[model samples]
Target chain A: MNGTLEISGLSKSYREPVLDHLDLTIDDGVFALLGPNGAGKTTLVSILTTLVLPDSGYARIGGVDVVTSPREARRLFAATGQETTLDDLLTGRENLVMLGRLLGLGRGATRRADALLEQFDLAPAGRRTVATYSGGMRRRLDLAASLLTQPAVLFLDEPTTGLDPVSRNRVWDDIRALAETGTTVFLTTQTLDEAEALADRIAVLRAGRLVADGTAEELIAAVGGQRLVLLDSERNEVRSIDTDGTAASLAHAMSSLHAHEQGLHVALRSPSLDDAFIALTQTHQEVAA
Target chain B: MTALAPDRPSSAHGVGPWRSSGVFIGRSLRHSLRDGEGMLMAVALPVILLLLFTYVFGGAIIADGYVDFVVPGVILTCAGYGAASVAVSVNRDITLGAMRRFRTLPIVSATVLAGHVVASVLRNLVATMIVILVALAIGFRPSATVLEWFGALGLVAMWILAITALFACIGLVSGSVEAANGYGFILLFLPYLSSAFVPIETMPAWLQPIATHQPMGPLVEAIRALLTGAGEAPALVSLAWSCGIIALSMVLITLALPRSKDR
Candidate 1:
């Protein structure tokens, strides 16, 4: 019954239904919430982080009910909201130290702040105010602040939404490092690439309801198998074959193609996570529509 | 690297409300000190008005003892108007997601407001002193007992507490920092129209009632009485105004704070 995160009958509505009796369970590792814009990703994160409340049902983190005992539950998780929730006037080091102290680190707060600054490769800019730092630096500082207490469950709400590719990769590396240490990171992203790259388990949400939940490969397989393409040099055209990831289908297609042509090319096109996500969302949209 | 291991939050211990408040208060104070133009305006505006009114308008406005009469009024004006910056500060925090971040933490919710209140009160105290010292340097002398001086200080403290709470609430409900600044100016203008700068009787008949009956008039009169070693009536009236403002603002702030979410 106890998991890293558990939600049941969790429903919330404002004007229209934002979350409709959504249920989810996660064991550990990086679990990503994949949805398009207005799919209630941020709203779910808001409720989990205790910044907002659900109208009905409840959510639990590590066996503590977030609605009934938010203060106790707050101890188990740290969140970096969609926006950069930082005191921009304060220097980066000061902001981290302040968070550390608030998390009950006491004198060790300074040491931790210093270490985090260096680890984030922001040691030179640590002394500068966050207002002066670039967007990527601010995101790194926000992440650093959230990790001040090294929370058991970390909620990152689109942590790299607006970052450049280089900065995004840097944040991705830090996220991986945190997971390697056994911190369960629950992230939400509209970008399928982000989810495919980082998530151990991916949940596709459509219109406030979960449409699919599985590993990347499983979802991809369920949606559709990969394609096998055969090119004939003389005709200057390509022929296609389908594979259910079986050696028999590939061998049969290859044998038929090889007997006919002197010059032939063959390739296998595996279904990408993007294909799975699109298929899942389109299926849900058609049903809802 | 393993160096990251040492930076973790030691043991997941929680912070007490008072400790969290102290940290926030320290941050608020640091912010105010670093804000050069705002700090200068908050501290120096009253002193400037005191000198300007005492020398420029003193002879024409008063028959005698102009400096002594206007100094208390100037101080009261400063006390009443000091909340503009507090409004800006509080509004900035709310609108910029600082308070949102704080709410997600394990610290007590009241701690954020407490820090703002403490910082506003301390800044008022220092600004009041600067105004008083400026009054002294300009040859304004009051023949009051030490106890009367203490009374003046106490009344000023209460006055600051009331106005800061009121303006902070205004800032909280305001749509933006610019709107909060506009509200703050309205508060700053109130004292000027009251007995803070001139006698209520000297105003036009229609405005006289407002000038005399509003909170600032009583507060200024009370401080003037204390400084001049006059009677207790003004002090009593001032205390009533201070308490009324504090109570009303507290109710308004409580009502408005809930609606400020996501703003």
Candidate 2:
């Protein structure tokens, strides 16, 4: 249970309940929370980061209760919000230095600012005002600022949503680097590729509730994998392999179809993470309906 | 792309408010100075108003001695312009999510607002000095002693601090920067309705009470007396008004600040 997150009966209501009585136990790793708009992804992240208060429930980060000891809980995590929050009027270097100072680095603030600027590849334009920076540069600067006070956990809300492919890759590398250092990352992203590429555990949220939680391979396998499709032209028969039906059953069904004809065509389509996500959410919708 | 190291310094330690406030205040001052349009509006508008009132309308309003009579009022009016800048800047920060970012940080939450308010006071003082210099250049004269001049500055500084706090509160309550400017107009126009540009005796009986009893009137009168050796400057009433505005502003700002859920 070390570096674990425990949430029990966490709920919030604004006009409508954005998060229901939810419970989860998350361990150290890159855990991606995937959901559609208004699925309470941001609301949940906000509450966990101590930016918003929950009506009821308990969320503990590294053994610190987020509600009762908010200040203490805040010290355990750093959040890079959905939007770029750097001061546009200040230069990139100034923003980092100021944040470093506020984080209690004191004399080390300047050195840390320089290191961050260099690491983020913003060294050349570090002196330029943030207002003049491109969107990608601003995103990088925002990420760099968040690293000023390295916390045990990092929350990135759609960190690379509007970024170009190269910038997105850069962010992906940074996130991987952070996780490699044993920092537990809670990321929310609309990009399925990002989730598949980095998430050790993925949770799908629908209607203010978690519909599925597992490793990518497990979820995809749970929905079944590699459907076998066959066409027997002579008898005009078709057969599909089901995971539950097993290899012997699938072979028997196919062989029965082939007994009546020699012109048989077969194709195996492996299920992807995208299939699992769609299937999980589709089931939630069916149940709700 | 350069490889980013996974190593980082831990940030669980707390930073004292005094150190954080110092950095925040410095940043605010730098921003205020760099804002060219704001600087022009704060410093130039008052100079233009002073020239217009002293040269164009001086003859029609009064035959002579208008310079000494109107100089203090012009200075106070300039301070009003500075208040508008404060309101706009504070409003921009709140709407832009900078305040939210600061709130999530480990530093003291109120330090950002305090920095902006203190910077506004400093800016207003600079603008007030510029207006006074311009007025003197354009034939305005005063007959005050060195000690009286210092006294006038202290009084004006206090008034500027109060007005800045009041406008900061207005900015917080306002929904947008444009709306904040609309709220600021109330303070900007207060000078015209007061005895700033003209004497209260010239106004109609109906407007005299308002023109005499308002905060701006007592402030202008107090500054005028100090600068020109006029008798009985209503210093007590002016001080009370300034203190009241500051107190009320603190309460309003506290209530209007952005909350965690609001962000």
* Sliding window of 10 residues with minimal summed lDDT for model 2 chain B: B1-10
- If you assessed candidate 1 against the hidden native complex, which CAPRI class would it receive? acceptable
Q: For model 1, what TM-score is found for chain B?
A: 0.91
Which ranges in model 1 have alpha carbons more than 4 Å from their true place? A1-3, A225-268, B1-7, B229-233, B258-263
lDDT of 1 by residue, B1-263 (tens): 23247546534566999999999999888787767777688778788888888889988988677888889878877776775577888888888878777777787855777788889888888888988888998887887789988988998999889888888788788899999888766766777777767777788999988887888777777888888754444787888888998999999888877421232
Please provide, for model 2 over A1-289, each residue's C-alpha lDDT reduced to its tens digit, 9 standing for 90 to 100: 1357889999998988889998988878999999888888999998888878899999998999888887777677778888888898899999999888887788888888999999889998999999999988988888888887667788899999998999899989888876876778899987789999899999998888998899998888888846677766767988766434477756765665545457888776677788788888888889989
Task: Please give, for residues B32-149, the per-residue lDDT of candidate 2 as tens digits.
Answer: 8779788888888778877788889987898898888888988988887686667877888888877767777766767787888888888888888888888888877788889889
Model 1 agreement with the true structure over A1-289: per-residue lDDT tens digits: 1228999999988889999999998878999999999999988998888878898988999989888888888788889988898888789999999988888889999998898898899899999888899999999999988878767789999999999999999999999988876778999998988998999999999999999999888888788766788778878999877677678877766676657567877788987888788889998899989
The CA-based lDDT of model 1 is what? 0.83
Q: Which candidate is the best by TM-score?
A: 2
For model 1, what is the alpha-carbon lDDT of residue A181?
A: 68
Report clash pairs, candidate 1. Answer: none
For every model shown, the clashing-pair count is 0, 0
